[model samples]
Target: MTVTETSATALHDDAVRTLEGWRTADAGQDRLRRDYLAHLAGHPDGLFRACLPAHITASALVVDPASGRVLLTLHPKVGIWLQMGGHCEPGDPDLAAAALREATEESGIPDLTLLTADGAPTPVMLDRHQVRCTGKDRPENTHLDVQYVALARPGAEALISEESLDLRWFGYDSLPELTDDSVRALVARARELTR
Candidate 1:
């Protein structure tokens, strides 16, 4: 294999192991985890391709430590407040790196750091959600999201990205009413993990 090909293969291997070994109390998440692993086993390009039946996504709950608030983006396409995340890029070594990169990029917080335990950032939640198919949209299928928690630098400012209509920080107890259950669950899991 060429160097790029080998690196991609190694990233796929890491994803397989990470998904296979993740533990979850939620039966739905557990099933999605299995389904994701199976999809990867069957499809060589499953990890990075957006048009797969279900593709792996990496996301992070960006929390401010001092105020215990979470940074959320108003996703234009989805039309909902959601965590910072997107499809896995070929340059991402693993899910955690992908999540961190997405959080930083989406929130425009360059100093955001993944909350780590035992010196390694860990996955805090797994989610599978359907996306409304826009004409010829890339991710017309479900998203199998591997979620992590990140901390923003104190007094950090957020710049809205073109992908989002707005970016704001919400208190843990007072998240926007339009926030979906999956994102709420992710926030709860993030709070638990970071604490």
Candidate 2:
């Protein structure tokens, strides 16, 4: 394998190990975790967006516990408020790093701390949904998303990137009405962790 292929393979191995070790009280979360693992096993390119059947994506909810605010990006294509994340790049060292990088790049916030367990970054939830990876209309494939929580420093200013139509912080209790329940649920669970 070439250097790029080797790097991606390493990340794929890391993802399998991470998901295998993750546990949740929620049955649906655990079920999705298994499904993700199976997908990775069945398709070597499961972690890449180019995998058309489905792909393992990483995303993080940027939260400021002290202020009770969560940062969300209005997705340009979906035209709805969502977390900072996308397709896993070949260079991403691991799922958590992919989530962190996406959060930083999209939020323009620095020094965010990932919520962790057992001295390692752990997932807050799993959300599998259909999406058009590109801005084109209609569902293209599934995004089997491994969601994590990121703690943003208080009063961290957010700058919107081209990937987002708009980026803003909303109180945990007052997320945008247009925001879907999955994101709201993510914020609720993230609040529980930060507490």
Candidate 3:
């Protein structure tokens, strides 16, 4: 059965199982992993962005394995270069699929391949950041981002989405100065996987 077709409850349960089984080498990441799991345990709507205060977000680092370049979106809201990804939809079947779906939509690049570990959509890394969407009464919210990597088809063209001010590819070693250390570390881990 397609579990995602059932209900939001299934999604939370699935997230719990996935996080519980994930193993990481980084001490900090392991702590974050536990935090993510705990968040899900406490918030049934944790996977959705509308969950106030904080929520889980899935993101993709679209990498061109043949060219050693990665796609980045200049986020219009945050005014920073970032990977393509955002809040999870109820239709998404799992975390990996959610990341892939977001990547495909934001990147507008077809035939991208999601790199997997042991045949699972295991995340390359996790990032937590604060965001405050513009407009009155929109308070600050925490984004618990689950970052994944995708192999962009060689020579694939990227189209900018409404969510970004610009979309461009940068060499792994040549990422723009506007990006934070989190993005740099994500690129580093993705590089190790691609190599």
Predicted candidate 2 versus true structure: per-residue lDDT over 1-195, tens digit per residue: 898999999999999999999999889888898999999999888999788868999999999999999999999888899999888999999999999999999999989879999999998899999888753754578999999998998888899889999999999999998789999899999998999
Tens digit of lDDT per residue, candidate 1, span 69-150? 8999998888899999988877788878999999999999898889875687878888888774433445368777888898
User: Could you tell which candidate, 1 or 3, scores higher by lDDT?
Assistant: 3
Query: 1 or 2, which is superior by lDDT?
Result: 2
lDDT of each: 0.83, 0.92, 0.88
RMSD each, Å: 2.0, 1.1, 2.3
* Cα misplacement distance, residue 118 of candidate 2 (Å): 1.0
What TM-score against the true fold does each predicted structure earn? 0.90, 0.97, 0.94
lDDT of 1: 0.83
User: Residue pairs in steric clash, candidate 1?
Assistant: none
lDDT value, residue 135 of candidate 3: 36
Residue 91 lDDT (model 1): 79
